[model samples]
Target: MGIYGALSTAVTGLRAQSFALENVSGNIANSQTIGFKRIDTDFVDLIPDAAPKRQTSGSVLAQAHSTNNVQGDVKGAATETYMAINGNGFFVVEPRAGQADGSATFSGANFYTRRGDFELDKSGYLVNGAGYYLKGLPIDAATQNISGSVPQVLQVSNAFLPAQQTTRVNYELNLPQLPKTPKYQASQSSGSELLSATDFMTLTPDQAATTTGAATTAGAATSSLASAGETLTIQIGATSRTYTFNSGGSTTMPAIDISDTSTDTIGEVLAAIQADLVTAGATGATVGLDGTGKIAITAGNATDTITVTDGTSGTSATGFNLANGTTDPTVATSTALAARVATVTADQTDDFLNQSVSGGAITVYSSNGAPAQIQMRWAKVNSTENGGAERWNLFVLTNGNATGSGTAWTRMGGDYTFGADGSPSPAIDHTDLPNLTVNGVLVGDIRLQHGAHGLTQFADPNGTAEVTTIKQNGYPAGEFVSVAVNDSGRVVVSYNNGQQLEVAQVVTANFNAVNQLKRMDGGLFAATSESGEPILDNGGGVIGSSLEASNTDISEEFTKLIVTQQAYAAGTKIVSTADEMLQQALNMLR
Candidate 1:
């Protein structure tokens, strides 16, 4: 190659250096742009075909090199809808084609972008700062699940959310073993801490079962006293009365004598005993013998208990087959027929309130968006310490202010019994409240779900129920308030009714050869043969309330700028020298 050839090569060098300088200038200009990827220039040399030793570099060419795969610095942003990718990904987007019928139209073609400064437009479309619309999978509000895998341009509106009826309530709580209720005192008996079953009974009177002694000879009341001066004692509550049998004395003599074995028959002896009980202020007490001549005794009131004892001197009480101790005629057990009334009558409302402890309350919505607050209470019907299995009953107040003859509360039917391990005996995971009506609003049947081992009967020193989790799957109708993106790439929308729902799923698109994508305006990219098809839902995590800064480094671009300037000047110097040599050759020829 001669001087002319050198001039042509110099020209190519200048072109390449100019291209490099242009790239550096562009990088420096967009150094602060959001989600900007800087471009670099690559030089390729052209060689002439010749023998191995004779081959020479002929020309130079400049080509644009992409830095699309490089990551930008992510920083927090003020906008809630703005997002940034932590690694490798692009947000699926599309440009608006045109407006028709006063509505924004979208081009069916999909474009990928890193600019996530998105906001809700007037038409309810999520558009970015560059006017590109975001694409995502619509989610079912009721089921809270993504509709499909295919993404479309999302348009979220501020429409009112319809009310949902309450179907189920998730509940998990711990019940105290020994509830220290208001009616319980340390000086009281061990079972006093539990609810009084008699106070809420409506079917039958809470009467103790009659206690019968061993059978004796029929109508043969003759000298079984083992001698005179034999005494028998019957005590009710704090009052005690004694009966002494005297020879030849009337069955009602001595004001405390019940019978004489020589003269009084068994019926007369029992009658005298009943009279003595009336005189001793045991008003409702009864003393009698069954048809088989067995001595039977009954207590007066529900609260009063009876204790019978034999005298030390004589076998008079023993002759009647009565032992020394408290009689079996005691208050009815909680499981008795009367204490199992399912509904709390108005007359028993006060007693019900005093027996049961608060079990928390929650407001639920009806199908028509009507709101009703449900109040719950837990009653300990039986305890292990009281010679019964640990059992409980849950009740809901129907009418707090109900008076005589009206229903006040209704029991959610179940004998919630617990085993020794503090877990439900049969594992009660759920129950239902049938047509629960509070105050006057009727709430349909709702399933009360208690997860595995959700209800516990532990020893709580405070003697209060601890509700760990209580939430219902229903809400009143609400107006939309705002929207936000989460780190999990879900679009969450908030409402005025204190409801937050996942309305859409924002998926990321990735490519095999991301650097080979065709760059477009507004930080967007189009797929190319070399870039491969868009692979979705497999990209890096999305960071919400943040933005990705430009990948261009100002200092590096400035350095390249200086180097390109020097190279361009050197190329110009080579052209000047080549022209001077041509002039020298012409002068020599002259």
Candidate 2:
């Protein structure tokens, strides 16, 4: 019985070694396989007795252990869809059981694998080298997000991709501290007139209360004041005073006499009237010309008034007429009221070639595959008003006239204001554009965002709008060009319209005890009770345009092969020696 037990043990050893040799052979054969996880032979002893002392040489049992978590070399590949996992996870896949004319059917049971040499099949299914279909979370077209938790078979469409409208734009620019044309200056009323109602009027109560105040003012003309002999009469605080201008050294003044029809220098006549008023005991009565060369008269007292007809003998022929009033009125200072400039007309606005500083143009698309050029213009607003406030008014041209001779430019929300520093302020972080509809077409509202460090106000001698960044989210309809997997484990499809869309997110599965998984055909694993349940993982990113090579090493497998061959040979020798011993015993019995 002992002899036969020895032979049986040797036979078990031979079987175990043969199993190990088979594992080695498999590893060696699949050394060039893509994403292949090598399997190693595990041996266990089956003892005849439970007690250690009584136990005989036990038989060896062979079990398979998988090196699933071992990483393989990810290499570049020509195929776009070929991807490799960089970390610990397997791509969720399903084996096709049935195939019809246009589609294939799956058994609904998920299988995990590392082989990712995938390509699009006839029905748009992503089939790998092992004929396994890849599964991933589908992205909703409307929301552009993963829809459900359960992953489904990912499909690629060969049809044309629809267009997307521009909803948001990013912009960063530096406004130079340059000069700008004053709109208020063009709108202000001009001041120039002869002595009449246009220049003189009844002073207001508040103005009258001030003893020394301007009655009226006008712009200077090349001509001088009325003739030197003109007698100008002014009522100061109820006392009418008359001053006569001498013809000596022709001079000009604010008020000339009604009798004088010939003109003279205003300066000389004003000095003569001032002398006369002082002599009449009305020293406070003053007459002067402002910076704009407008004549102004001040009464001696608060209640003093300068009625043009006070001392005149009702002579309308030559006397300074007060009944007829002038439109321009004199103020304390020379600075006059400026006009408000809101919208620019064709004449006020500038053309693309002339007015714009430095700007860039971008092409955006509408929903119906309509391509429109978005022209940007940075018109200097005010460099002198706000103490060197570097401000630029942005304008958008949507199929607008390039000449800007018409009202084709639509102004963007606010002026791009830049401070002294080279950074932009958060106060003008984002501006909402006006045109919901462009060129009679309905597009969504576009919002432009400027980062904190995006804009600058430095004095750029070039006077061009130095744009730092510009981008928009919009594309026209495009035909399918290619598809690839990104590093984030997402399926991105490219189009002929120079656009890329993330269609689906690849899903991965991991297990706590990977060795316990049951091995399947084509380097696959099935979850079992011994192996923990599959846990969904996204940490392992995908390498695009690459394939994972087999983890098996030929040299290691050959080394194990040599050991397995020697062990099998030793087991055969033990069995032969045990057979000879049994034969000898039988011969003695004979």
> What's each prediction's TM-score?
0.80, 0.69
Across residues 1-590, which tens digit of lDDT does each residue of candidate 2 receive?
Answer: 38888899899899999888888988888999999988899999988866777777578899888898898899999998999998888899999889777578777889989999999987788999888999988878677788778878898888898888887778877665552222223243321110111111333321111123233233221123334445555654445665554444433343444233333334544556666676766657775664544455555543333443322222223223223111112211112111112333344344333544546877666678676777776665434342223445666664354233445556576545455564544366777865555555666677777765666677666545678899998888899998888878889989999988888989899899977878788778799998889998754688888999999988889899999999999999998999899899999976
Q: In lDDT terms, how accurate is model 2?
A: 0.65
lDDT against the true structure, per candidate, is 0.79, 0.65
Candidate 1 C-alpha lDDT tens digits along 322-362: 64554222222332322454778888876777777788898
Model 2: how far residue 9 lies from native, Å: 1.3
